[model samples]
Target: MDLAEMIKILDRQLTTEGRTIHVDKAKEHMRIEQRTSGQGVSLSLSELLRRYHEDGEEALNQTILAIDRGLHAMASAPHLKGKESKIFPVIRSASFPDHTSDGRRLITSAHTAETKIFYALDLGDACRLIDDQFLDQEGLDEQSLIELASFNLSALPIKIKKDVVKNNTFYFIHTNDGFDASRILNRKLVSDMQAKAHGDLTVAIPHQDVLIFGDVVNPEGYDILAQMTMKFYTSGTIRITMLPFIIEKGKLEPIFIMANKRPMPGKSKR
Candidate 1:
């Protein structure tokens, strides 16, 4: 079927398959964020249908193709930016409340939400949280859904400005006012780093942020990474340093860093 017809068919099939739909016309962009049970699927479907109705199939197709190309490019070049560029994020994930059921946050209450978040996928990382199989069952083929699963965070890209190393840990800094680093990039970077070098390829997204990736093997290395990260904070190099987290079992498990004499260990988690 053509794009418009395909969109219409998909919409009807989505409801028949027992899915809910939501749309945010207030925002100029059409992003398919996280899907819990099934929120983002129809929300995105409706938005894409709306676009097809308004701009016609050709325009919608062009946008899809552009996003696909952008995602392919982002796999290698993380800092890619500027006009004609797209934040080709690859996966939809469930965002969690950072606290207990009472809504008290373990970190900050600012981000505790029962919403969906999207991330660019690195080919190396496995997608969890959402059931891709469900999409395929909803009359959408696997390949097309895979290509379109990513959110177009922005056409303006995020750039990495600088990086430094101390105690063999690499500290990467992305350009300010750009898209925040997603989970997909985090996985690829850490996996690639551990492969190239050694030690646990750890990470932390503090604020908008100062993206820190490193291999902290010993207490001294953690000390150095934490110290410099704090110094950067004092220097205004980054805004806030959220507690760093590690990747395990293809997921981000958050942890707090305590200084000197064997920092509190984040429980071994998946």
Candidate 2:
């Protein structure tokens, strides 16, 4: 019963049934398959502890492919994107925009299938043509992408200078739902031909992909919680994904999370 022992038997069957765990219905009961050798599929543990004892563990701990052997140990590591520029660990997908109650910011999907996973440092070949157009492998050119993902030919240091900020603040952890949850959780939505081809005309708000994990001397924010604990509670789902970067001067960046702070080494043995 992987997925961290079916979230410890669905957090002891939702603490003996008083009911409360609903991280988006445990991320909508988790699921993912994608395979053909690009390496995918894993996380069974008797069907995720019988669906987390029939549903709970925050409703089911959604995505990262529902953690089955931690998404086949991150799609089978050692792919090392051509072996260099280390600091791997990724997995992303995000979007924003969908507001109202007077602020009006359309473009909705009611939150596009969220997903997340940090840690980076692979500048060396800018992800080899998007991992050869979706992991068919082979692509790192520019001088073998600086002899394999740069930054001193990789031993993990693509560029993670500004240190330590555990759980720095990547949250979609919702439940209140009365609206104005910080402007509908930081909304977003552009696409009027991509916001007038980048001029960003106006009125298209609602953007919720937060992460405030502080550092440089406890700048604040901290809540590295990957929680799950359930067992029969019904109607559950939880999903929060935001992994895409490019915004130079307002912080809110991406990649770089393991200074060996620990807890990732085993990924619960696949």
Candidate 3:
């Protein structure tokens, strides 16, 4: 197949294998099939074409074949290139039986075989790409890198996050673990959420994550939430994602101010 077609195939396999980036190539390109660059598991277009130019069509065939093997490895193995490892979902559907109504169950994380050395990784760490050299090159420490990941792309918590925001206090939720970033019940917080938190707890953010414990029994308390959310977003500190929601008595109750759509024009009066 042509170089573009070959890339399309590899990318498709990456998607089917549930990888954000199956092949690493330069992001900006001047032309199709032009070789920009490649990193680790990702293949660059020029790199692929070089192979084709050297060996003709057989080069394309061999590369595609290699990609097929990678897809298989991705399914059965935790992709590793030196010290760093890809991250996956931490919890599975079997973890919770009651919330069978498409909550965390909707998340799909890879299953990887683990062999410990200096460090260990699990299928749950899929959302993150942790590399010693990469982090060093970026001029960031592991802790801060992990914290940055936790705040946005990942659900994995590198350490106990920022101070817990109590009722009437302004706080934020963040995680490095990406799969369950929205999930309020973390391994560390499960027992507490189950035994301690009663009604009137809300998780606000740019994303539908990071719980804020507030007293709903207080009049205009929820209004305070809306104001806080708007200020946090508009203050240019964070990017607001989903409309804010609350865990009132252990259930998801969407706030009216966050609603984006109205009822149809033709409907019976309530």
Model 3: residue 42 alpha-carbon error in angstroms: 20
| TM-score, one value per model | 0.39, 0.23, 0.34
What TM-score, to 2 decimals, does candidate 2 have? 0.23
Model 1 lDDT on a 0 to 1 scale: 0.41
Positional deviation of 190 in candidate 1, in angstroms? 3.4
By TM-score, is 1 or 3 better? 1
List model 2 lDDT by residue over 33-144, tens digit each.
3343322222334545565566545435542223343333433444545444453332233432223223433222222234222223333322211232223344443344
Which stretches of model 2 miss by more than 4 angstroms? 1-92, 95-175, 178-236, 242-248, 259-270
C-alpha lDDT of residue 190 in model 3: 38
lDDT of 2: 0.28
Model 3: weakest 10-residue lDDT segment is 111-120
lDDT of 1 by residue, 200-244 (tens): 556655433346676666555556666665655433311334455
Give the candidates in order of lDDT, highest first.
1, 3, 2
